[model samples]
Target chain A: MSQDQYFIAVDWGSTRLRAFLCKHSLNANIELVARNNGPGVTKVSDSFEKTLFDCIEPWTTEYGRLPIYLAGQIGSSIGWRETEYLPCPISPEQVASKCLIFEELGHEISILPGLSCLLPNQHYDLMRGEELQVLGWLNQRPENRKGQHLICLPGTHTKWVFVNNGQIIMFKTAMTGELYDILVNHSILIQNKTASFDQAAFDQGAKFTLQSEAGSFVHGLFSVRSKQLFSQITGQQSTSYLSGLLIGSDVRAAINANEWNVDSLDKIALIGAPHLSKSFARVLELEGYKTEICKLTQTTLAGFSSVFRATESSLITTS
Target chain B: MSQDQYFIAVDWGSTRLRAFLCKHSLNANIELVARNNGPGVTKVSDSFEKTLFDCIEPWTTEYGRLPIYLAGQIGSSIGWRETEYLPCPISPEQVASKCLIFEELGHEISILPGLSCLLPNQHYDLMRGEELQVLGWLNQRPENRKGQHLICLPGTHTKWVFVNNGQIIMFKTAMTGELYDILVNHSILIQNKTASFDQAAFDQGAKFTLQSEAGSFVHGLFSVRSKQLFSQITGQQSTSYLSGLLIGSDVRAAINANEWNVDSLDKIALIGAPHLSKSFARVLELEGYKTEICKLTQTTLAGFSSVFRATESSLITTS
Candidate 1:
């Protein structure tokens, strides 16, 4: 703990609100000081301020009036203040400028705007928190910014983004995680199965999906039940099989899109939870795409700090 | 209506236990006399006998130990009697011959065995109640025994069957309706919506799915939310879009399998609720396939009667 607390960073989404007390070290790195998670936007309802303040109470009190930068659903139409989405190819400057700035209880805070894009894939798409995380990830790798790169942020809504020359060109989302959650929890196929990870089952599911006769996701899904019927799959392994099936489908679609050269798309960075990232990493590798696993929180913090610094510099110049 | 009461046919399943008091018409028809639905096997738990008796008390008291023909989950491992599965290429006789026979309260009861098969698509498959319904449909049209027909029984689990000359050669199940239920009821995607049938939305969803980038069910699902985001699809239309996307995907996969000649597949039979049957009919029609819609309950009665008659004829010969 050589460095002191610098600022407060929050990644607030629909299900949960997480806050990180960070330190801007001498080497210009985001060192984590402390963390707190509270009810997310959906649960907080009218008590958004109460929940946000309740969790960051200790940190806020210690830092006095330090700046707080937030991202994700906190700026959604249902969040504390709704912010307009800046269309891609959006730079970090566009995001910072569009951030909704407001004050509460003698405190200064800004919520970043989300990104919307007209995908080349004949569909329109948008992402809230993950876009900022992508920005955070890009800010850390300036050397690799000159060329085109593909980044996948695996989550409830897995995003497949095309980044060209430091700007997000376009992105599309695949509802893999959310679908997996519903199928395992509410579906008759695997509702009785637990969420325990089984590597073999998962690998089998992914492999089956990849080799699936072209364009048959709905059919492959029903295999979960049939596999169980033929005693090829057990209840415990059903969940993993589902996970592999969904993740493998998601990856296969991206590969088929011809957006990424699987053989040459070296190091498609995975920025998400370690467990989820590893699952995605395995599936991508099996399909001949190299992957670099990165922590979600780190990238989110880096993104928040990057925008906060840009705003800070502008303020200094204006004064 | 001209026929007199003859036998009791029960379509016993996981969630609903339906008993039909049928009449053996002189014209070789099974006329409906009365019907009752009790707590399904899943809800009744181990007290299956109590629930069944409670619902059909009036009929049993009047008929005095009539023969009961049971099908579906009533004969599953969790049902009152665990019956064996008749392998595919099975005829009505095979199903009737393997019926789990027993006596209860001076009453003779027969539970028809389910169908299991290794699909031509290389997946193991099984069906309980739907197989019985298919048998009923086939029994009504003896002429259909000469050729192959594609039959779709749409419901919670939609079944696409390939029947050849009075035998069910093979079939595949798509979790379309069930997936639709969970998504509209539980998934964060569109959980707050009602099940109002939106004709336009459904048509749009089904059509959109038909044109979806090959092999990407997971990606297209996320578009339901994106379409809403882009204001191209409203909340009222979300359910239909989901329905269309799923049904379209299900139908497309079957068509692309190289197993069926879509242009010459001639008159695909649809057996299910009128509303859902029509939805599948519309989608299949849009893809240039002919669909013959039939009532599920009617087909179930015909199927049960066909088997019951076979058993009755054998009893007389044995005596």
Candidate 2:
């Protein structure tokens, strides 16, 4: 096996840290060797290095000092090392160029730069980890690199990226996931906090936003409370309803901000965990767009591997 | 004093309880004799009656078992007594007729019914205490009873009420205040949550929602964090910025749902405490509508007095 075949990708977000032991196989395609998760950036009690090594000690002992690429909030100000946010319109190479490379504890490390864009409305949108998923998605298929694509990465901060010819031109973030978290856990709108997924309730909530007077999000939020009050919807179904409402609002925001007519758009690529990505895909399809769902980890690994290929020799020599 | 002259008006919401001791003066206008505050419906560990009497024992002792009128969350299912919600278009008389009246501890207690409306979009909008503000605002001036009026009651659930010829034609509720509370207290968007108001930051936030694509509220919320990340806004200014963004969205929701042209609307009556009312009034005026701010205590008193006059004899007789 080539020395460059072995590497690791770490996704350290606010709540959890996922590390993938990956290797370029004889076929020259990346394959996962093992996977482990530890505390997130916020949850680490000891140093991040200690927490990371604890999770990957067995792999490191077996493989011997592999190059590691870290993404997400792990590269944020609160993370091990704060990386610069590269501005869009940017390609994977441009993002790789801005990586914060350093040597630590007999390991070569590259902290990926986050992405930022000043939207047309003079609003600044920033994303740390989702850029890797976008890059990976684009790298996964040749067709993805050739055309205009609107990619929706659904998470705590959902990023709607407008891509043209493999570069992210601009993107917007919606606080849909975060809002849902607080509302369900804190607000009076939801009484039954069951994690039960009710498809009909979800669709109904989505339709409520679709039919509501355009951008009546603040207004529609109250229905989560009033609908319960009037027995229009039960407490059991409220969580799903609230989810549908917010996701629908997010979809509407992207379409309205980008001025993308649903009928005219060819396809939207949704990148995230299966549940959230599928939810977004369902709503987008309802709005008259074709959608393809991509697993978050796969795309993220692809993105890191592609970038690793380009920047490997330089990072290794410096370390 | 004439037996009919003395009565008490109470506004009991989820957070606080306020009661006004009032009487009809020689001029036949209602005047407040004294005021007292107590635990809200939610904060009452003891019986609500005990909590009420604890605050107003002095007045009740001096006044000798006067008639009492109650409004707000105190009239909901979780309140002291669950009153029905009267559907719009409803007049104050219609509201009074639906009051839950009974004798309790030798006092004539009448719990007011809340108002509900099926909006044009088929969403059910409901309000408890704010109906009193709408009734009081219209009763305060003869002209208010004669034409179309938009009344905004800003609170945890802000109510946008449309009154036509002395009845509430329709209304909608926005979870702006509640959303603000959660975001400030729980979300990652705000860091420094000083309650200090920054006018410039507020205007910037308000204009952000205004200039962005109509209904881009979900998208705009993330800017509260990203703007800070980019140093476009500071931590201290975040609370005000968030307030402006949510209030601006609330206003936009009303405008879009009602399809009201900013230039065509004559005036919007903002009924709340001075601080919140003024903030809303300033935004409405900026949007080209003249605004009048009404004090909450005064409006609640006026609304109770109006309804009291209609139902006083029946309630007094029953007790």
Candidate 3:
């Protein structure tokens, strides 16, 4: 008989729902079984329960009442259930302990709450999908749960998370990707003719972030437009230059972070897509930091597993 | 004999053409007789001649064979005709001397060439309408042109110009207003529920730009969103905070400018709308700089007058 059982991890976000069906081995190794995606909370709106089951029914029919764990926007107020955000300096175990349980599909459903940090100004900084990735990074290797580590998750909203001894201490989010998107797509800074990447232009932009006299990013962005008008850079090249400038600014901000110095962040773990990570990796390398890339899905699944282990044994039962 | 003659001054830009009908007194002062506006280059596109005539027909009919002087984007490639940018350090006289002439409506029409400054990086920073305003500020008082002065014109794109001895030395453009518009409208930053201005929130935003360690303007902009999400700042307050942040960054960047020290720019001439100028003046005052708001239409008319004086009598006479 197979010593493998099925479990589902859903990283439900604002725009999309990504569900992974995995095989849990007797030795605690989780292997991907199948992956399914559906419309996120945005598209399904008030019909999330219906939409989620509609996409994951095939896996449930084959696996027969497997335990399901959810994270990210799914737990947001606009999502399936409004779970309260757990204040920071909390551990992965605490996150798992607080996962809200819902009775549906004749099975147990656990939803993870996001992490929140109160700034000195009393403004709260938060992350929905990233908390899992942080936990997953640690779960990938128990040794990773030790010591201090800088974790970067690059996406539409790039986050620089600080963790110490397996607990998420605090972190800041940079709207680097979103600004790049809006400027390139909407602002006159770039007339992006093609979506192709240019390493040189991006490098130039990255270099600009290092120049303090170049003015604040608000002042610096005009260089793209000026360069284009002066023929210093082409329309096609502006895209990469702009990307480098924004990403470089993000890195610069992280460097200016109070949590740790540059040497302390010599090696940082990055959880993101390979393509996006490559751009960030280039900037980090230039800024004298070593980056280690971890697949987002792997970290996400690993995160769910870590939370599962933290929960009561009585909560999840064998089928 | 009547000591006044009517003329038309049009501040033509990409989006709008604002024409001022002024009665020129014998003493060189221009009084507003009437005002007219029409769709700019973008709206009329290839039908520039038709649009130009349509908007100016009323003025032409009232003031027979009026000498029409134009400044700004109407001289660009997308405008009525393509006029090359006059390289900087060139005087108002030179701009007027270089004005492109066209015969229309049995009268002479003059289009002033925009000013272009080649940066140290060889990136050309160009200005269309602001050039006239700078010269007009100088023209307002010939003594004002005897020394170096800083001039700021706030708009969709803010321009900071340095004038020395009746000539524009150099200028830099910041996309602050445009960035604010895009973020509030398109980006994830603000869900601004109302259009009202909150001075306190704006002050807070402006204050953020002064923190060097807060990282670049790119890093700071994210706080608006965080503040909104945390409920530390209301959606209504975000619009003002964002404005303050962007304007503050502009001031900070200007303070950090290499052109001249902050003390050297104690009193900068500002040419913009009253409402926009008030916001800029507030930030400047907070930063220990004095701002003098000049009427835009006045500077424009005075600029046209300066340009007109520079033009040869033979060129402006009816054919």
TM-score of each: 0.93, 0.96, 0.94
* TM, chain A, every candidate: 0.94, 0.95, 0.94
DockQ (Cα-based) for each candidate: 0.62, 0.80, 0.57
CAPRI grade of model 3: medium
Model 1 chain B: lowest-lDDT 10 consecutive positions: B1-10
lDDT string, candidate 3, B1-319, tens digits? 2578777888888788898887877777778888888877677755766777777788777677887888878888767778888888887777778889988868788998888987554456888878888878899996778878888899999998988888888888888889888988888777654669888999989887665454556667778877777777888899999999899988788777776666865598889988888899899899788889999888888888887666744355533
Question: Per-residue lDDT of B1-319 in model 2, one digit per residue for the tens?
Answer: 3643888889898999999999965454889999999888889999998898888899989978988889889998899889888899988778888888889899989899998888777788788888887878877888999878888889888988888889888888888899999999999988787759999888888878766786689889999999888898889999999999988888877776653444555888888878888888877766777887888788888888788777865556777
lDDT of 3 by residue, A1-319 (tens): 2577678889998888999998877687888889999888778844777787888899888878877889888898778888877899998888888889987968789898988886554446888878999998988887788888898899989888888888888888888888888887898787665759989999988887665464457767888877777777788899999999889888887877655665764588888988788899899999778999899888888887777666734355442
User: Which scores better on TM-score, 2 or 3?
Assistant: 2
Candidate 1 docks with a DockQ of 0.62
Top of the candidates by lDDT: 2
Q: Fraction of the real A/B interface contacts present in each candidate?
A: 0.75, 0.87, 0.67
lDDT of 2 by residue, A1-319 (tens): 3644888899889899999999876554889889999998999999988998899999999988998899999999999999988889998778887888888899988899999887766777889988998889878888888868888999888988888888988888888999999999999988889759999889989989977776699988999888888888888999999999999999877777753444556888899879999999888878887898888788888988778876864556678
Ranking of all predicted structures according to lDDT, beginning with the best and ending with the worst? 2, 1, 3
Q: Write the per-residue lDDT of candidate 1 for residues B1-319, one digit (tens) a residue.
A: 2245478888888888899998886667788999988777888855777777777789889877788889989988889989887788888777788888998877798988888888665677788888887888889887767688888899888888888889898887788888888888877668447757788888888877788677778888888888888888888788888888999998888787655665666788999989889988999899888899998888989998888778886886888
Q: Per-residue CA lDDT of candidate 1, range A42-123, in tens?
A: 8885577778788889987887777888899999888889888789997777788777888877778899888898866567
Cα lDDT, model 3, residue B241: 92
